[model samples]
Target: PAAPANSGPLTRPQPVSLGMNAPAGPPTWFVCGAAGAGLGPADSYDVVVRIAHPESVYDLDLYGGTTDPDEAAAILAEALVGDLADPHPGSDSRRSTTVLAQLLGPFKAVHGRFPSVPELRQLLDGAAGPLAALRKALTATGHESLLRELDARERQMGHPGDVGAVLADRIALLDRPAFAGFFDTSGQSRPFSLKALDHPVRVRIDLPERGHADASRILARLVLAQFTASVTVRDDRSLFACLLLDDATGVVTPEAVRAVQRLRSANAGVALTLRTLDDVPRPLRGPLLGATGCRMAFSGLTPWDGQDFAEVWGKEWTEARDVTDRQIIAETPAGKAFTVVRRVITGKAPTARAVTVRQVERERWSASELAHGVPAGHAVLSLTTVKGEHAPPLLVDLRGGPRV
Candidate 1:
C-alpha cells in the first residue's frame, strides 16, 4: 500500500518494513525471489532498486518546465507524429516534426512559455504571418540559425500541406471551448513537469475520457513521452521513479519500448495496462512483450492475446504417461479355472496393465488455458529482475488466494 503524501525533507533514505501478519488459512506456496539489500537487515538491496515516496502529482504539461527548449519541442513533436493517419507521407511527416520543433523552440524562448492551443494552431497554419513578433525577437537577438529555420518553414509552406493538415486537425480537438481553461501557457492553471521526478512524489492525472477521447489520447501520449525523456536524464538516480498508465491503448510506440529497456539503469520503471494486444500495432506486439520485465495475461483475454503470451513464455519439458491394459489368456486348465473363479467373484475379465512414461515439450501456459482454463480473479504472470534474473510464468491469484 502507498504511504500518505510526504512533504518534509528527506535527509536520509527510508527503509521499507514489512510485518508478518498472515491471516488464518491453508498453507499456500509462494514464489519468492531474492530481496534486494535496501529491504534492510529485514531485507536486501540492489543498486538498481531503491524505494522513495512521491512528492507531487499533476497532469502533464506539453512544454515541461525545462530550460532546454529543443528537448521540449522534440517531446511535443514525438507526441504529434505518433498515431498519424495511414497514407501519411513519411517525408511530409518528418518535415512537419522538424518545422514544429524549430518554431516551438524559438517561440518558447522568445516568449516565457509555450503558446496556447489557438496560438499553436496559428503557428502551424501561418508561422510567418502570426509569429511576426517572435521573428523580430529572434532577429534582435542575432539568432541567425533560428532566422534560417523560419525561412525554411516559410519555404515549406509553399509545398504540399498534408502533414500540417493532419496535425492541425488533431490540435483542433483541444482548441475547443471545453479545454479553454487548460493547456494554456499563460499561467491559468498549474503546470507539472516530469523532469522533477528526482524528488519523491506521487502524481495522478485523470484524463477527461468522457467527451474528449482524442484529446485525452494526445495528452496521454504527450505525458508518456515526457516521462520517458525526464527519467533518462535525471541528475539523481537514487530515487526509483515509476509511471503507471492505467489504460495505455494507443500510447505504445517504438521509442517508448526503447525507453522501457533503459529504465533498469535509470532506476525507474513504467507499468502500462491494455485491454488487448490488438491495441498495440501488429509489428510492435512481439517487441513490446520482449522489452517488458513482467508480462501479465488476465482471465478474460481472447485466444489471440493468449497466443502471444504463450509464444513469449514458450514451452517446457514435462512427463507424459500412457497406460495400456491387455486381457490374459490362460494356457493351462488350472489357470483358466482360477481365472474363471476370480472373474465370477469380480464379475469382470482379468487383465494385465502396462505403463509408459516419457518426457515431452509443452507450452508453459497454452493459449487455451490462458483464455479459458484460468479461474476468475486469476492471471498468469512472469517477472524478471534488474540483475537479469527471471521467474518462469506462474498463475497468480488476484484475490489473495494461493499462487502457483
Candidate 2:
C-alpha cells in the first residue's frame, strides 16, 4: 500500500502502515496547525528530523517512538545487519578490532586501546577466551543482560573464532552511512573552536527511537559530553553553544546536570524539553534546575509542580481592603441639630474618611494560578542574571518574543 498522494507541505519519504490489513491507500490528512508562528504535527511515522543552520553548529538529540523490546531488537538488527565499519574484515585492518575493544569499556580501560582481534587472539589459549572477556566486559558496563542475548545470537551465526566479530557487528550500525559522520569518526583533532571561527558550522544528529532507545541514550550522552567539553575551552560572546535534547528522560546524566552550571561561563547552555515534571528523573531534577538561571513553563504543569514553582517564585504583596459597614447619611441643614442625638444613640458617627485598607502579602502566582491561569500561547518565564539579579515569573506572549 502507498500513502495517499496528499502530502501538503509535508516532508516526503514518510512511512505508512503498508501491512496486509492496512488501507490499500495511506491516509490523506489535514494539517492541524497552520504555518507562520506555530508548528504542526508530523502525521507519518518515519522521518529524518533534519536541523540545518548556516554558519552554526547544533547537536540535536531527538527521541520518540514505540518503546517495545521486541520491536527495539528488530529495529536495531535491521540497522546493524551489514558490514560494520570495517568493510574489509578479511584484510586485517585495525578498525573492527578497535570498535569491539572500545565497545567493551573494561577491556578498553585495561588494554589502553583495544588490540586488533588477531593480536588478542594470539595472546589467548582458547576460542572461549575472548568470549569470557566479552562476558566480563558486559558485566563491567552493567549491560549483563546483553551477554545472554549475545550468546543466543552467537549460537545462531558464529563459529569458533567469530565471537568478538559478531559482538562488534551488533553495533556496527553506527559505522554505516546513516551514522557515518556521528558515531564512526576518523577522530579528527583540530583547533576547531567556535570562538576562533569567522563562520559557524551546524551538525544535527537525529536519533529517533525507531525502537531501541538504548542507542539514542548513548548517543545523547556522547554528544552532550562533546558539546559541553568543547564549550569548556572557549567563551567568545559570538560563540554561543547550545545542546538541545528533545524528550530528554533517563538520558540526562548527573554530568549533564553539572554541565548546565559549567557551560554557563563558556557562553554555552543545555536545553532539555520533556512532557512534564514526571518525565524528569526525581534525583537529578533539583540539581538540574538549581544550576540553571532561567526556567520557562507552558500550560501543562500539574498542581504539585505548580506548587514547586510557586514556592521558588515566592510571594509579592498587593493592596487589599477590609470593609466595615459604616455609611454616612447626609443631614439636611435644618436637621443638623439632631446629629449629636443620632450620634449618641448610634454610639458612633460616620466620618469623612469613609474607607481605609492596607496592603497584604500573597504569593505572586499561586499554585492554582500557575496550573490554570496561564492561557494558550503564553508562558511563565523566570529569568536570573549572572550578576545574581532575579526577576519574578512573567506571563509573556510567546509569539511576541524576539526570534531566537
By TM-score, the best candidate is 1
* Candidate 1 per-residue C-alpha lDDT over 13-103 given as tens digits, one digit per residue, 9 for 90 to 100: 2212111221222111111111121112322221111111122222236676665766766676667767654456532445556767767
Collision count for each candidate, in order:
13, 6
* Deviating ranges (above 4 Å) for candidate 2: 1-128, 131-182, 185-199, 235-238, 326-356, 386-388, 401-404
lDDT of each: 0.65, 0.45
Cα lDDT, model 2, residue 240:
47
Model 1 TM-score is 0.77
Cα deviation at 30, candidate 2, in Å, is 32
List candidate 1 segments past 4 Å from native: 1-60, 85-87, 90-96, 326-352
Native-structure RMSD, model 1: 9.9
- Taking the tens digit of each residue's C-alpha lDDT, what string does model 2 give over 1-404? 00012222121111121112223222211111111211223322212132221221322221112123332222222222221223334222232233232333333343444333233332222256665776677777776556555454346334544434543433442334444333211223111222221223332244534544544554445445545544665534344445445445444555566666886676555555555666555666666667767776666567767776676677888898765665566678745656667788878775545456788889988889877888755668788865679987788765566522
**Model 1 whole-model lDDT (C-alpha atoms):** 0.65
